[model samples]
Target: MSEVRTIGILGGGQLGRMLSVAASRLGLRCHIYEPGANPPAAEVAHACTTASYEDEAALRAFARSVDVITYEFENIPTSALDLLEDLRPIRPGREALRVSQDRLTEKSFLRDLGLATAPFADVTDAASMTVALDGIGTPAILKTRRLGYDGKGQARLSTPADAEAARAAMNGAPAILEGFVDFSREISVIAARNADGDVACFDPGENLHDNGILRRTTVPAGIPGPMRMDAVLIASKILNALDYVGVLGVELFVTPGGLVVNEIAPRVHNSGHWTQNGCVVDQFEQHIRAVAGWPLGDGARHADVVMENLIGEDMERVPELARRPDTALHLYGKAETRAGRKMGHANIVTAKSS
Candidate 1:
């Protein structure tokens, strides 16, 4: 057994909540630092710090109280992390956060590493959009440079006439225009890298989306043999490039030509949530092992799985889902359910033939 240490998580959302539960199973305690009271993670953590990221005194206190630090989300302000890093070690480190924070920088960085990404150009104004459109053409996506997720902060331009509309919709934020990818399907690989330079990746999962939010994810993505290997290779490449020391989610588009990276999530991802029932070591537990200097777990799947997101009102079917023997229900303890909010998720597992 490895030495157990108290882990400090920077966010108090559902991801942090799940991570805290996983940490407890390994004899480690988790302290959640969040600005608001009653965050989901707070309920299960050893302690909770209610202070804004700008509170240097609180940040210092929180950092001093933990062995090592990690974050549940990537949108954390860089300055806040810098303050905590001064007091304790932050895994998956600042470089990964910086690169994943900005869409333009992320795409450029991936391209520089000889990775395939959709054709893209920077956009700060109408003229820049016009120029980018001229190069990348229409039917492209215009996305904000920072703080975009779950299909937010993005606009799709189907024609030249939509360029002005797209620019206006972004409200002058620095953005990127990406040429549309004609892909057959979308998939993601959830992988973990440890401080000792070890990496373990789960099987690729096929994904389906509705109105830009992920609706369902099925494992054994049903792609050709080479495509499965290609997906895992792409994810490993991103983890190695970042020198990442935690679980990372790599989203990919399976295009006619080949696999193309769409985005990177620096923490446990929604796509991998099915592992909770399908695999012995779920992404949450795997992440805790990586960040705590413990040996990484085997990521092999023992069952075929399908995970569905319960968006807002869809959570009403929880009672029904929970009654199914093969289904596992996970609900984020949120106060209210608004449209587009992820209220919970359900995973259906089926044992595979040996």
Candidate 2:
């Protein structure tokens, strides 16, 4: 394990909290850097630096104290990472972060690698939106270039009349219009790549969304064998392309033609949370292994599992889910439950006959 004992995480949300817990199991420690107080990760981490990303002195101190660094989310400011890169090794690296930070850049990077993504064009204003609409047509999605997630900063344009208002809503942020894909289901592959160029992928999990937030993810994806293999291969290609180290979530649209890349997340992801109880090694531990420069674990599923997100008011049902023998409940220590916020998740595992 190279005797690397401490990991520094860039975000202090639930992902970092779970990662810290996983690190502890492997005899390692975690230090979280986040701007907010009482972050979930801070509760379990060995240390925490509550400083804004713009605070260079705090960032420098955080870098000097850790052996390696990784981020829980992709929205981390590039400038902060640029400073930290000079002081410590950051897993999954800047290239992966750069690719994932912008929707247009991410799509273009995938296209350059000869991967399939929905047709898209950069739209900065009404003029570009008009041009992009001409090529991609209506019934498209216009998403902001940065800081968007869980259905935020995105609008659907079903007809030409809706295009102007959609552009106005974004307030002139750099955006992209993506031609919608007619797909049967949304699936994601959780893959991990180590420093030594070894890659391992968990089973592709089929996903369902409620109001654009991931509602449920079930393994076996109910797809044909070839289709499942295709999803795995696509995830592997993305990890290899970025020379990534850590878990990567590749969201795909399973269309009649084949799997199409929707986006990539360069950290432990929600869809793979079921691995905590369903697999020999969960995505969080795999991420800890990758960032720590250790050998990756067996990415084998031990049970048929379904992961359901506890969104907003869903947290009220914790008592009910906890009563079920087959369900494992995880509640994030968030004080407020705003609409659409991801509060926690529950994993239901069932043994499968060989």
| Total clashes for model 2 | 0
Per-model CA lDDT versus the true structure: 0.91, 0.93
The segments of candidate 1 whose C-alpha lies over 4 angstroms from its true place after superposition are 1-4
The number of the candidate with the highest lDDT is 2
What is the C-alpha lDDT profile of model 1 across 17-136, one tens digit per residue?
A: 999999999999999999987898998999999999999899999999999999998989878888888888898889899999999889988998888999999998878878999999
On residues 1-354, what C-alpha lDDT tens digit does candidate 2 reach at each position? 477899999999999999999999899999999999999999999999999999999999999999999999999888898899999999989999999999999999999988889999999878888999999997999999999998899999999889988888798798999999998999999999999999999998999998779999998688888988898888989899999999999999988888889999989999999899888889999999999999999898889899999999999889999999999998889999988888999999899522
Which window of 10 residues has the lowest lDDT sum in candidate 1? Answer: 345-354
C-alpha lDDT (0 to 100) for residue 53 of candidate 2: 100
- Model 1 residue 40 CA deviation (Å) reads 1.0
